[model samples]
Target: MELSLLFEISMLLTSACAVLLAGWLLWQGQRQRAMPALAGFAAMMALWCAGHIAIVQQWPVLGIALVLANPLMPMFFLHFAVQFVADGSKPLPAWLQRGKLLPVLYGVTGSIILLSWLGGGGKVISSSGFSAFFVFQGIGWLNLLYTVLLGIAAHLILWQGWRIHSGNKRRSIVAMFLAGGWGLLLATSFVFPSLGLNWYPYPMLLLPSYLLLLVYGVVRYQVLAINAFANKALLWLGMLLLVLALMALVSALLGQLGMQALSAVPASQLWLYSALLLLLSAACYQPLSQLARRLIYPGGQLDESLLAHWRAELQQAQSWQELALRAGNLLSARLRREVSVQLPAAGDTATGLHILCRRDSSGWQYQLTGWDDVTPGYRLQGEVFAALLLSSCRILEQSLKLADAERKRLDQQHLVELGALSAAMAHELRNPLNIIAMAAATTPAETRGHIQQQLKRADRLIADLLSYSGQLQLQCSRLPLKPLLQTILSQQDWQGVQCQLKVPDGLTLYADSYRVQQVLINLTDNALAFCRNQAQAQICIETQHDNGDILLYVHNNGPAIMPQQHNSLFQPFVSKRAGGSGLGLAIVRRIMQAHGGDVCHRTDLGWPVSFELKFKQQPSALSTQIQDNIND
Candidate 1:
């Protein structure tokens, strides 16, 4: 093919690739305003490439129009780079921010160039005539001047972006620089010929490679979205293209060899030679394609090795801390930096050399430091390592949660066994105690009274144990709160202390009636005891509805519990009263919990000392039946 035709074909291919890349970028949702500018840049470059092809093909009018519009491409690139580097919150430099002037200039110059060409004032006299001082020369010099100026400005903006950006963003900017620089180098073919130098446009054939690099940046670094698989797809596509190209090359070589052999042999043997060449080409295609793929895509093996090693290390990690340490060591070796890993402090910053990876679900924060030597590729490695560290941390956390759950289950089983044994022993001792109490009744009244009191204490202890063990079956039903409170108050001795009931009428509770009664009796007894030493002793039982639940409060005009003792007060064997078995409140708490409610001491309430019981208000079949019976 003629060199000019080859250049045209190359330019056409580059234009198509550029347009496709521009379309893909613009179609993405996460591409901010900078991405649209980038898309515009790509589209304008494609148009410029098409203009070159048109010029080479002798379409002067169409070529001039496209060439006149070429300045817009670099301007668009500069605009994009400026925006890409700028932090949104900060204003850009006044000159850099004013992008409207470039388009205005392009419009004015483009019109001038078109008018000059139409007026027969501009014509190419020699290859160097574009820059030569010819009186009737077109606006070629002006176009060249503007192109150079815009290209310089675009590079400067890119450099600024590279300086300002960090981490993966800086890497993307570097990729853009390399790609754009390579395209500009190839573009020098036009410059050399314009300067009247003898040069082939073969360099321009590599223009499509520039677009590929930009596409690689978009995919590999995830300029749009952080997708690791996009890079994998790009790598696979590259490998496939390499294989196809090698197959074509092999076929071309075989065809050349067959033509030479046929030229040396007789015409009758031409068909035989062609068939043998065809077979040979086919035989070589796969092996050549495989060889090319191996040479061109050798990084796949290295990546796989790295991934496997990291995955194994991650699996062996015992905790988040261990994962961080191991990951830091791996990163240090890979990146050639002194790396330290630790949990992030409250005020730790993630700027500069620090890379912070946080997993809120696991409450883990990995701070990777000493990244001063980090390059773009090393930054990517750090990101992958951080991800691996996070995965390991999540696995470790889940394992710990499972282990803790298992431990709790085993402890509960042991508690059940111990409770069953205690209950059996208590039942066996109860009969003997009853007989002893009866026998003691034949003695003096005081001794008999003491023996009966001791027996009652033992019985209460056994009942408390049963409640804690969850052995007491609940018969939950709806009951009027007012009636229950009144019955309990009527049965209590009061001991000169005033008792008040503020339970609302018609208010109902769904709970085991017997267990609820037992809970209330325990609260009232404790309240009465605490209030006994008060100047104006009083106790109050009240109920209120809150958040789809019933809240019952037993209040006493007594000293408040100390803040330090609040948590342990509900635990078994913990009490503030003298000679108290300390099981009353514990049993009350356990019974309330078994009813799907909870008991808690409330110092912040209507009285100084109070205990609140919260119960869910959902109606059950038994509750509904009891309500109907009450109504009837």
Candidate 2:
């Protein structure tokens, strides 16, 4: 009698818990894709428990309802496992799709069993010791077979998912696998006593074990996304309620067992003891709840210390590029993904932490490539950490900006001193060269030619120094692109060289004509020097419009510049070719920069050596001319 009463109490408690969990899981549907199936399975489990309670109360209809719903519980569990492992953006597994008719077949089998029992083809044997037993007469064993098969199938799917996934996702599936497999194994044991076995079927006592595992999965791995119910007060209240339920359960079981200590207490005095116990539990709630939270979220407060460390490390960054690299590396280590930081001018490619620095006035964006792989714990605290990280980046940007300003100021001062020295050298060297040229003219013809060539080289070097050291003053006008190219090419002596002009006759560029001419001359000279020995040497000048800017490409069939020299190609006083003025490309770059343009070496399909000039579209009187050219 005691065991029967104890069984009844356990059924009531587990049923109530299942219902509550089902409701909560269903409410979490907004965040979890698997919630509906898990919630439905929980509801079915609650109904199964209620069926036992109804049978004890002599309610046969509800008992039959449990038989009808038995096959569905396992199906729901299998569905939950499939959706749990399946990605929302991807299709379901092929096996699942192929077995779509299995659920319908199971439903039909269950309905046939229900009909057989209702049509007097089955018998229900009730025991008088307050325990209910189920017996299927004709086709009822088929229902048991279906239930066992479905349960096995569900567990197989879970095992497959466990083997397939890794990391936190796999851990969550392990919880489900253990819980579902254990629950099915125990719950299946309930039918043994009806099969002419002398088993007591005490597995009901261990029925809640699976439910506890499910709770672990939900809490630890974010399987159900219960973050909404994770508030401190709510968590404490839940703990308190759990303790109260456990106390009630233990007291009821003890009373059923007829324990001497509890049997001696009066019914009236028990209320006072219960009230005192509640008061004591209330008092201890704070510390217990704190411990629970600490266990659940050990890394919740870790970001504060990490943020401090990041701030210190980021403070030591010397430039914007260095700061961005350091910040990207820090975030990548913390989030465990590939992260890249790009300036606003570099273009956005991925979705991630965008730090808008009002201090630097240039928005710095960080892209985290695999954001979906971030663990839930860090994702929950992402906003706070991102804000702190952004603040750190902004502070670094400010410091780097100040440092750059000082550096630029010093560079400008150095350039002023260098410019003064260059001017004085050019003036002194020109007078001595003039005297030498006159002296060499009186020598033999061969000596005179060599001296003149040396003097010309010196003069060209002086001219290059002056061009590099001097500031540019632009007198911008709309110059016809084709006519300008023709004039520049006509001035150059390309001996038996093919020079193709691809500029449109109507295309006009808004730039300083003199500066543009100098830029073209320097590019042509650079090209000719590289390809002077190659037979059938060719140079091609082409113009195209791109995003409101004009792109001028000069291509030459010359040996490609070595990769080692690319960086210092436009740097003054760096040259590899003999009898070459190294400042030619440097002066060209300066002239282009003064016109709000840029020059860069590019590798095209056929051209081994190519230089591209990018001219910004000016919003001046040339707009009409530019628009006409675009239309043409």
Candidate 3:
């Protein structure tokens, strides 16, 4: 083909590719706001390419019409850049926004240029006594000046956007600048021919290089929000082209060798030679394809051995943090990018490239910094790696949950065994203790009193153990708060202490009356033990209804519990007061839990120390069955 014809064909193909890519992006919902403008730019370039071919073919009217229509190309490009960066939210400066008027001025100028060219009054006259280059002298100069002005304005806008953006966004803007800069250079090439240098190549012929750079930006950097790696249709097309190129190459090499050998063969034998060549090409197709895939897509598939090794590593990971670290290292090594993992902690400051998996209260963050040159094959690999990482995280979370559940189950079993032993020991000691009390009663009144007090303490301890063992049953009933509090306060020994009830008369609780009394008594005793030394020792009993639950707060004028002891304060045998059985709070918590309620220490209430008991307004069937079993 002739050189100009070859250039024209290249320009047409490039323009078609550009148009198809932009249109496909628009259709696929990739950067919808910016894609239409990019499509317009591509379509205008296609028109320009067509116009150049027309000009080459001596079609003046069509060429002039297309060239005049070409002024809107840069406007569309500028529109795309602005939309891409601002994302239709950031307001452009007034001067930059005024660029929308350039197309209107260019249209009027194009009309004048066309008129001047038709009137034959704008031909450039060479001083070398030779006529050269057909262009509208006055109008073409004016058009060139406006094109330069538009190009400069577009670059300035792009530069401002680039400077304002950061990180990934900044990278995308840089790609835009590179693509647009090359486009500007091509646009400037038009000035050469208008300056009486008609020997210069047509600016449209440079479309292929410009389109390639734009495609790189779109596909690799996702400059237009077009993730070409994720586009299966585009990937298939690329693979098809690669296969075809490989076949052509293999056939050409084989054909040359066959032709050399068949140079002495007769014309009748040419058909046999052609048949042999076809057979050989078919035979080599699979092997060549495999070779091409290996060379071109090294990272497309994960090795089975590598995957198995990773699985082993994941199994050995002790915690989520350890698993995250291993996963980050694996991905970093595979992708050749800096990778970091962030685990959830107090005031955690780690960040990631993206979040891979998040479930329940756990998540995984992966970093892919410095992987800007990532190919479709590598991207596919990264996706597979991400899947692996997510699966590993899921497995780790499940393991932790199962382990925690098993530990709780075992701890409960141990507590049950301990409680049964304590119950047996208390039963055995009760008879002997009663006999000893009887013997002490005969010896002296003082001895009898001391023995009775020690016997009572042992009995209370036994009762607490039974409650802890889940043997204590609840007879749940809807009971009013006011009368229950009055009766309990009248019965309790309140020496040198004042008790205040803040409960509303209408408020009621759904719990066993006896068990609720026991809970209040224990709380009051614990409070009085701490506040007895105070000049105004006081206990405040308050109740509130919240979100279908009843909250009862027992406040005491006592020191607050230290933060470190908060977690273990409710466990059996853990007491802060000297010569006191630690089972009071523990039994309180156990009773509340069994009743389908909960008890927690709170410092935000009526006094320095308070314990809140939360009871469900309406008990579920399960809680009723549990309460019945406990009573049995």
- Candidate with maximal TM-score: 2
In candidate 2, position 555 carries an lDDT of 95
Off by over 4 Å in 3: 1-310, 319-356, 360-386, 443-445, 496-500, 543-547, 603-607, 623-632
Candidate 1, residues 295-346, lDDT tens digits: the string is 6544222367887898888678666566656766776676566555553232
What would the TM-scores of all predictions be?
Answer: 0.42, 0.49, 0.47
lDDT of 2 at 385: 49
Tens digits of per-residue lDDT, candidate 2, 71-178, equal 678777777877777743434468676756557755665675566556643345654344566555555666667777777777777677776777777788777766
Model 2 CA lDDT for position 245:
66
Better of 1 and 3 by lDDT: 1
- Candidate 3 lDDT, 1-632, residue by residue in tens: 24555555766677677677667656764545776777777787778667655665667567666665555676677667776666644566676576666467557545654554555433333212113223545555555555566566666777787777666656767887788778777766554555656554556466677865775574455444445443743555465556556555555566567765535443324433554565576568769987887788776766789888877886778787777777778767876765565444312324444334454544554444434567767766766676677677767778988898888778677777877798798789888988887788776778778888888987877777776665656777778988988988888777788888998877878788888888888888888888888878888998887898889999988778899999998988999987678888888887787677889998786578989999877756435434332212
| Candidate 1 global lDDT | 0.69
lDDT of each: 0.69, 0.71, 0.68
Query: What C-alpha lDDT does candidate 2 achieve relative to the native structure?
Result: 0.71
- Model 3 — which ten-residue stretch has the worst lDDT? 125-134
Decreasing lDDT order of the candidates: 2, 1, 3
Of the two candidates 1 and 2, the one with more favorable lDDT, higher being better, is: 2
